[model samples]
Target: MMILKLLAPIILFAIAILQGLFAEKINKIKWLKITLICLLLGSLTVGLIIISLDEKNANNFSKQQKDNIDSLRIENAQLKNNLDSLHRALTKGMDDRSLQEIELNKKVSELNIKLEPFVKLALTKYPAYDLQSALNKIAQDIENAKKLAEPPILIPNAQEISRDKTGLNMLLQFKLSKNQSLGQIIFYAEIEDGSTAKIVEFWPSTKGGAFNSGPDSKMIAPDGKSSRLIYSLIGAGNPTFDLKVTKAVTVRITSNYLPEPFITKIE
Candidate 1:
């Protein structure tokens, strides 16, 4: 635009000189008409050049504006995508946290249910106690109960040893100090004359019942002195011993609850 402004005056001056020289060579009226035509052409040429340059500049500006709009659109799309991704990630994280909390609560509930019985028992036993103290007291009480329920540990004492020669049998009497339920007893006999005595049957005079003995499941003791014969009898009984022995024999009676054995000699 600045270059066009500077050249406009120069172009007008050159046109005016050409027209003046032509006016001197032609008639006055014709010379005036020719000068008017030259001035009109020069103005038209300058106007066309200004319009062309303006159009070129306008086109360049429009192209740049379009490019800027396109860039902004792309940036806006990218921002939207990023925001969507962040939203999804946050939602998933919150869901995971909620699930974890639910699982933890469920486990706690199950544990509380399992402990409810013990808690009630403790509260009933110890009215004035904290939870921990009550639980400890409950455990100690359970241990005491187990100890009390155990059977008494005592060695058997054999008395009133007599033999009946007519029946060919021996009667041995024993009793448990504390009147408890009867347990199993294992007994065997060793003959003095180095003969093996096998027990065939056992009969007790006590009202409980006849004693039970198994001859098929007999086993020898580790010391080889007596054969193992198991008998189930009442706590107190005078059981008649029927054995296939021709010589004098010593009978030994033992039980799981006894620390020692009861022994009796019959001749």
Candidate 2:
């Protein structure tokens, strides 16, 4: 259709040229010459109209193509922005999961440290087939131990407190159920003579080193069923006191993965 429109103008113009040439040849026939000249002018006018209409149609087509291209570019830009946003969301999710995995691993390590004593005892005393059963029993016993109102340990007394000639020393004993472990301990002491003994620190023995207090400490609980902790105290220069003068001792004890601390007072 486009080709036919373009050709139509040229065909009309050609016919007009042919008619003008033929009219000159028939100059002798005056009426026929006039008719041929009129035909020539009419064809020329029609050709001009066809050319103008075709040019206008071409311009409209070009404008419509430009508008379509602009719409396509807008859609492409929107798609690219959506893809970028999705990528950012996925990256953030992965980073969050990584952090959660690290925290879970830390908790698992702490649990293993707390349970090491029980696992070892079970392996030594029970056969391989009965090891799991032994661990279950140990866990049950520890739960039962936690339910007791009184602490399952002997409070420190002047007779039980060992003294160092150079410094004040107080020792307390804890007799735990089989495979039970210890978590945290804090102490408060009072003297009968109303004197204060400045304490440096108190700690339990794990293996051969002092047990540190904190979440990071991975020290295994005391082996076997009994454990002891000692407190070292300082005094003014050479202050000394008779053991009989020792009055009250209070302790806050936390044991074996328990969530709360237990306060025990000995008089």
Candidate 3:
């Protein structure tokens, strides 16, 4: 713009001199006006051309921006769809888990009801016994009850037993840490008296104390921690010189590890 301004005055002076010398015959004023008017017209034409090119570039820039926006919208839509699909999958998994839990609970309820009779028999006859052994008996019965309850699968194994330090008496026990998740389980056991028969007792080992034979499931003993149950059977004070040994009792220890729940008689 400065170069144009500098050249405009010089071009005007030359044109004016030429007009004054040739057409006006030394009329300088009229020739100067014509020269200035010519310069003004040339400046106007150049300015208009620049303005037109700027407007064309602006239109092209606007079109490119619209295309970029359209592409971004498509990508955004696809992302939203993927998120929705994942949400649906997560919700479905939670629903399936709840249904399975309900079914499992129902089956357990039915099994407990079917085993009620056996449970009462043990409670009445072996008033004194071990809780752990009772649980083991239940496991055994479950295996045995398979013929009656065919719908469920019960893994059968030989009853477990633990011998005492003297090797004459036995200890019995079972763990619910594995079966605890099942909530509750009921069991039963028996001591058959024969030509060789004996007497035994039972007690519960829980967050409670040893079998003081004083209370049911909720008793806590003097020990700081819960006691494992120990059931015992000692010889009846008198021994006869009979040739035939008539006193004997066959006891199935819950598992060899568990001993009967007993302590010095409270009496």
Candidate 4:
């Protein structure tokens, strides 16, 4: 669009053209017609110039907007590509972690199977103190192999607590048997000032037994009549019918093969 900016020059140009075309054409000099023609031509020229300038400005503005839109589209594409790459990397890491966890579980299962037989054999024989100790150690080893795992020995053993007066005789008795071969016996007993103690934690000490005796094909329980090897008579080891004891004491016994145990108390 184009427009005439010099308003006075456009008016003079329009008047000259009107004079050249109609000065001699009028009968008695028509002043109304002449002025009307000059005024109309002047207005048209100015309107055209303004319209041209407005069109040019509008075109320039549109081009600038298009350029900005193109630049934004390119930036958006780059960001989308970056996001996709990060997603793929994170997916790969998750897959690797899943695979590692599966392998570790399989290994643990295998180890547990291997340890089962040794534990079973130890309990079956003589059902003595050492055999039970070995069973406990095996369970401990299993626990150490795994991180943040519970102790296998959480399963309670035979435990009891009792009190006896200074002059009164106290007796310890148990029914014992073996499900496996004759392994050495292991026993635990403890004397405490108070009768109350956490039976599972406060393990008793052992007194008498062929503790570490190896491969005893023949085993005997002191009572013989009981058939199964019930070793303790008075204390955890042995004593007569009347024995003096002070304070309260607890005792616990375990055999590797047997699921059950022997427990008694005296004070």
Clashes of each: 0, 0, 26, 28
What TM-score does each of the candidates earn? 0.40, 0.46, 0.36, 0.37
Q: Superposing every Cα of model 3 onto the true structure, what RMSD results?
A: 19.4
The reply for model 2, stretches above 4 Å from the true place, is 1-21, 125-131, 147-267
How would the candidate models be sorted by lDDT, starting from the highest?
1, 2, 4, 3
Candidate 1 local lDDT, 1-267, one digit each (tens): 877766766777776776678765544578666666777687668868888988998999999999999999999999999999999999999999999999999999999999999999999989899989999999999998887787755543344433454323555545554556666755555544454553433334444346666655366555445555566764455333333333356666564655676655656
Model 4 regions lying over 4 Å from their true place: 1-21, 25-45, 48-52, 79-165, 179-186, 193-244, 247-267
Superior candidate under lDDT, 2 versus 4: 2
Ranking by TM-score: 2, 1, 4, 3
Give the per-residue lDDT of model 2 (tens digit) for 122-220.
767665537789898777777877766443333222224444444444444443333223334433223223234333333443322244445432322
What lDDT score goes with residue 63 in model 1? 95
Candidate maximizing lDDT = 1
Measured on C-alpha atoms, candidate 2 has an lDDT of 0.51
The candidate, 1 or 3, that scores higher on TM-score is 1
**Which lDDT value does model 3 have at 62?**
90
Per-residue CA lDDT of model 4 for 1-267, tens digit only, reads: 222556646676776686678666642567756665667666676667667777888888898889899989988999898999999989999999989989988888898798679767656533664866878866676677663342222133232334443322333322333122232333333333444332222111343222222333223333221111222223223211111233344434344423556444544
